[model samples]
Target: MRLTDFTELMRNEFGTMASDSMLRDHVLSDLGNRTGAVAIEEGVDPREVWLALCRDFDVPRDRWYLHPS
Candidate 1:
């Protein structure tokens, strides 16, 4: 799938403020599932997915560890 479509799916699935740790866990938990089911579906490394999320949301990588709920 296209990056834009993948990004939108990430946003929709995770919500606006999905925590980085949560994202990490989500990806890990679903690692065996179809690639399209995870955020980095297009062979993007999980770290890259987290970095992209941090960049897009303007959240510092360090701050992403804090629990949002």
Candidate 2:
């Protein structure tokens, strides 16, 4: 997914402040122990980062994809 899409998903799922904190602070072991921001900075796909976040935090499988509008 595009960075914009990833960013929007993060905000939509976690709210702005918490999403920002997670991107900065939550170390995603699946992404080599890098925070979401760092993984993205190192060229990881935003989609992978998003899924890692979901798995790490136990976000429901149904919510992994964006909702239909």
Candidate 3:
């Protein structure tokens, strides 16, 4: 997915402030223990970062992919 899509998904799922905090502070093990923003800057896939976030936060499996109502 594009970076824009990743940004929107993060905001949609975690609110603007929380998403920003996570991207800045949450270290993702799957990305070599790098924060989301750093990992993305180093060329990690946003989808991979999102999945790592979901795993770290224990987000429900059903919610991994967005579903329109």
lDDT of each: 0.48, 0.92, 0.87
C-alpha lDDT of candidate 3 relative to the true structure = 0.87
lDDT of 2 at 15: 99
- Please write out the lDDT profile of model 3 over residues 1-69, one tens digit for every residue: 788888888898899999999999999888898999999999888888888998998888787784332
lDDT of model 2, residue 47: 92
- Model 2 worst lDDT window (10 residues): 60-69
At residue 31, candidate 2 shows an lDDT of 94
Q: What's the TM-score of each model vs. the native?
A: 0.34, 0.92, 0.89
Runs of candidate 3 with Cα error greater than 4 angstroms are 66-69
Q: Which residue pairs show backbone clashes in model 2? A: none
TM-score of 3: 0.89
Ranking by TM-score: 2, 3, 1
1-69, model 2: which lDDT tens digit per residue?
Answer: 888889899999999999999999999999999999999999998899999999999999998985332
In terms of lDDT, the best-performing candidate is 2
